[model samples]
Target: MDESSVRKMSPRRAAELLSKTPGEELSLQAWEGLREVCVSGMQDERLSADERIGWAAAGALVVDRMRDHSECADRRVAMASEARLRAYVITRFGREDDSSLRDLSLLIRRVVDAVGAESWVVADSADGWQRMTRHEMLELRRIKNLVTPFKSILPLLSPTDPLRDKIKEWVDIIPLLP
Candidate 1:
């Protein structure tokens, strides 16, 4: 049969046929379930930022996740295949051409360079680390020592420039695809 006809088959009927037939498309049917779960999770609006990170951290390619995770809601992994993941990085993110692994590596380098070597980090207990804007960090630092400090404590610097090596320790963003 053709793609559409097979897609329309009930899961039970498809499985029995696969057992009787040679090279039956059980894989495609399985993937359909996975894809549905992934699409549903992607559509969930109630996920928190950390929860979103958890989703990103699943590390499955959209195609794989769409295929496999749609099968089960609880077990979805982020982009599971490198080839598909690389394709997504190029297509969805800024890299249009030269989406090769090496090209992606280069883009990461450029981004790191643009951010500069020195900076202030603001950490939220639940929200993870954020590097404050230069102006905000400065005003916090300058006024922190003067006057009866009230709410500026959160804003002011503790005089730290979390080392470049430490910054490098950030969870590998490239791995998000596969």
Candidate 2:
């Protein structure tokens, strides 16, 4: 479909398109609508688990497209998409099948890219907080909030798994933040 048509599409229709369409095929406006659908879908308690997974998958696609078109995509949209996708995966970690595990790994990598070495660098030291702007502190807090849920999911992963280690690292550092 054309950009104009996608812009005019309803949320339900946009979600349908999201499930079936590639992110590169849709305009950013369409992605906005898709993002709306995903955020709501993930939050809606009445939706079946499978349905939420579908929304999470679509959100992942949006993040992937944003990564590919980093220059063209809005940073806000990419960051929000990554945040939502990561939350969904981490919340549902133990329940996911093998394929979702693969998706989770990719999502983790994207998050690492988004947050960069900030996770390692902060350590929530007094000096780190002194050096950062208010905006930077809030962004780290946002990331901390996102990963805090991993504390519950951590036990589900094997001790030897690198993802488990990453989650442990995040859960460990976040509490040190003010």
Candidate 3:
């Protein structure tokens, strides 16, 4: 599909297309379309919260797939995708709520693992454990703070949750103090 065709699609329809399309044939156009749909869905006031969350989650998954396939070849695109995922979490769940904290921690850790510090340094010249963008620093702090509350309840979280593994990696890379 072309950019124009994808842009005209509704969020639900875009997500449908994304889900239906074979992974090998998934084009940049389709990805952009889904991203646009998510962006527009978040901005639309008429959509229900559940609908918006669905779109946002779909968008994040698309980015995650992109990262896995592309191997962070395009640093700018990777960074933008991660940022959009974070924005979706913030927009959907708010910044400081329990849900937001948990979800945002997951999102941040996903970026750290998927994109890696090398990609981030290449993309923004953010040295590992030294100079980071304010946003990156904030995300690290948020992940730490959020994970603290879940340590005792960790068994309740799904075993498949990446947080169980990625939190240790985040701690090793992200400086404890900004």
Best prediction by lDDT: 2
Any runs in candidate 3 off by more than 4 Å, and if so which? 1-17, 68-72, 95-102, 118-178
> How well does each candidate superpose onto the true structure, as a TM-score?
0.22, 0.59, 0.49
Worst 10 residues of 3 by lDDT: 145-154
List the global CA lDDT of all models: 0.32, 0.60, 0.52
What CA root-mean-square deviation does each model show from the true structure? 18.3, 5.2, 9.3
Q: Write candidate 3's Cα lDDT for 1-178 as tens digits.
A: 5446655666567667766655446665566565666666655668776666666755765665555454345544544565555644564455442544226565555555544454234323324535677787655444344323323333433668655554444334334434
TM-score, candidate number 3: 0.49
Summarize candidate 1's per-residue lDDT along 1-178 as a digit string, tens digits: 3334433544334334433432223454544443344333333457553333223223233233333433433221222232223323333332322533324444334333333322222122112213556655443332221111112121221337322233333222212111
Worst 10 residues of 2 by lDDT: 93-102
The runs of at least 3 residues in candidate 2 whose Cα sits more than 4 Å from the true structure, single-residue gaps closed, are: 1-16, 19-33, 62-77, 93-102, 124-131, 135-139, 142-146, 158-162
Say which prediction, candidate 1 or candidate 2, comes out ahead on TM-score. 2
Q: What is the lDDT of residue 15 in candidate 3?
A: 65
- Cα error, residue 176 of model 2, in Å, equals 2.8
lDDT ranking, best first = 2, 3, 1
CA shift of 32, model 1, Å? 2.9
